[model samples]
Target: MTQLTVFGTLTTLSPFHMAHAGVSAEIDQNGRVRKLGTGTAKLPCTPTYKVPFPLSGDLAVGFDGTVRAIAEVPCLPGTSIRGKLRRVIAKRIKRHFIATGQLLSREAYHCIQCGAFSGDGIKANLTTSAEVIAADQQLFTGIFGGGPRLFRSNLRTHDSYLYCAETEATDVLPVIPETTALIRAYQATFAHPFIRRDDLLDFLDPIAPDVIENYAEAFESWQNTVLVTQERKALDRNAALEARAAKKRGEVVEKPEASAPTEKQKKVMLKGQSALEAVMPGVNFGFRIDIRGDDAQCGLVLAGIVDMIKEENFGGKCASGYGRMAAHLRVMNERQEEFPFLDYDGRKLLVGNQIKSYDDALESGLSQLTSASFEAIYNPKTEPSPRKGKKTDDHDDDEG
Candidate 1:
């Protein structure tokens, strides 16, 4: 069985900053430390974080502190990829599952990217941990695994994409005794990590046992009501319109006059050099997308993803031109056949017998879909909590 495989490279055009760095101390007119900014105080440091996945032992004993070796494990979290892809999917299929129509989950403070339950691909309930272990058996749970749309399995971010991190040659060598050099002038930076199906399952293990306990309950109690974001609810235009109409009807309304809108400012915290670490440009990461079958829905999804890369920049700093990268897409069959989707500007998808790409569909536009669309999908209110299985408490150790 030939699945749809998409393999490509992501060439970073600029420095990628997944974090927000406040301007630290700056250089004054003279060669003295201004002492105002929150520059790190680690005494000329490099980032020391294992922010990526597929956790390794490379940083075992004295590697990072001694060698200051630049690691090549800046893996783009699978969740992040799912997020970006879903946004693209939402834009194309007119499905807003990625952004809108969210309900505060039963779990305290648990939020989301709006997800679909893959249901372990059984369309039935799983009663035991053994079943979960068994079900996961023929599954492809990698970053590009097409399982989400194929097996109907529920997945919350678990895949880790790949990236490369390099160390400067000068940093690798020491001044005197390689192991005795107490003096150094530089540090190395690394990327994220690459995770597999097993690696991502770490997030689900907590909910493993009773995941499908209330399967029917979830599907049954699901609601289709659309709720705007907390922010939107405050600025509802319909309420304002209603207030104006009520006043025109000779009814005294208590609506206040509109005031100038003030933009909310983010508070910046000052941190010393201990807080700086990021991915530099000129780094490339390769990706592979494999789908179970070659279907139009898949084709539309691919097109939507391409459009996202074309319209928006990658990573976090688009406004500052930080995460700009190129995505090349193509479709292939088991017979080693390849369809260069990128070469076409969605024209090929448009001329098909049916609507192949959502670029033209009214329902496919993301802006058109909102909390209302989720009404037709699954309800977050009904989603089973990530916490499952036997409970543990202080009383467990007490005698009856």
Candidate 2:
């Protein structure tokens, strides 16, 4: 049987940051050494966290005790890609089950058989682990395999390295050492510095009360409901503890003081600054995924990949518009002569051996996954309730 492979180039639509904890110390303009990392440290203004991009290796310290920059090669590990795809696929599967309702109890059994859905698919629990294992043998689980037995996944995702202009070949992903050689000086990643200001409302306080009445009310509500409630609770607990300690010391304690917002709290709420080392928008990376499965499994996996590209953001700081990527993908069988597939840009997919629009392709895959024939392989009717067996953990290694 020919194996299916999905190969692609993923290009960043926005700046992306994946922080590595390795710290580097360098002398600032003030001639004092400052450490850079995704950790707490004192900055010129205030103590804050600094986030740095994943480096090829930690910065080296010279014999003179000065820290120097090492070659930096930004990369996206396969684990991140695989983990996210599994989650998206699982979510889609659950939604499909929900959409079908009671129209197909047999199809619902397939989900129940696989323990991945957290019992949403279970109508009645099977008596034995062996029975559960037999019932769980569905196409999705068979391909992405994770359960008590720790079955190996049929899918293998390769680490994607940063793609430079010289490495335009997306057919095969290059290794880190090779990628480092291809890196251009101008293509080195840089951090985007930003200051977060929570004091915008403070400036508005000076405006006439009538004009700012709505804003004031909204701010007051948030401050009272969230910040004040939490802070007061903490303060009250501390005060009570102090009173208890004084009583133990045989000293008279005056009435405990009401909690007041501290100076540190004011500083934290007013202003903050940090920087994230990030790859610039439009940077590309080469990725590959190989799976030992039939067309049904291939189509399902393809649908999940498309969903991740179109709807989800990768890496860190997605809330700040980082990690958005567009995929330029191609799908094919290993023995090209046996099962031919066409190259695909971001907007299309292979459905029934023909290139189809994204929506149609997605629908086609989901249909097959939700079909009766697909689920019949693990039909609950075929299995009888066996002797009760020991419970087993469903956790499986992501790397597998």
Instruction: Write down the TM-score of every candidate.
Output: 0.40, 0.54
Predicted candidate 1: what Cα RMSD to the true structure? 23.1
The residue-by-residue lDDT of candidate 2 on 18-115, one tens digit each, is 65544443223442333432223223121112222222222234324555454234677787788778777867777886787623454444343443
| Candidate 2 TM-score versus the reference | 0.54
Over 166-206, each residue of candidate 1 has an lDDT whose tens digit, in order, gives: 21122221112222212111122333321223211233355
Q: Model 1 scores what on Cα lDDT?
A: 0.38
Worst 10 contiguous positions by lDDT, candidate 2: 44-53
lDDT, model 2: 0.54
**Best of the candidates, TM-score:** 2
- Candidates in order have lDDT scores of 0.38, 0.54
Off by over 4 Å in 1: 19-72, 95-113, 116-276, 343-400
Clash count of each predicted structure: 22, 0
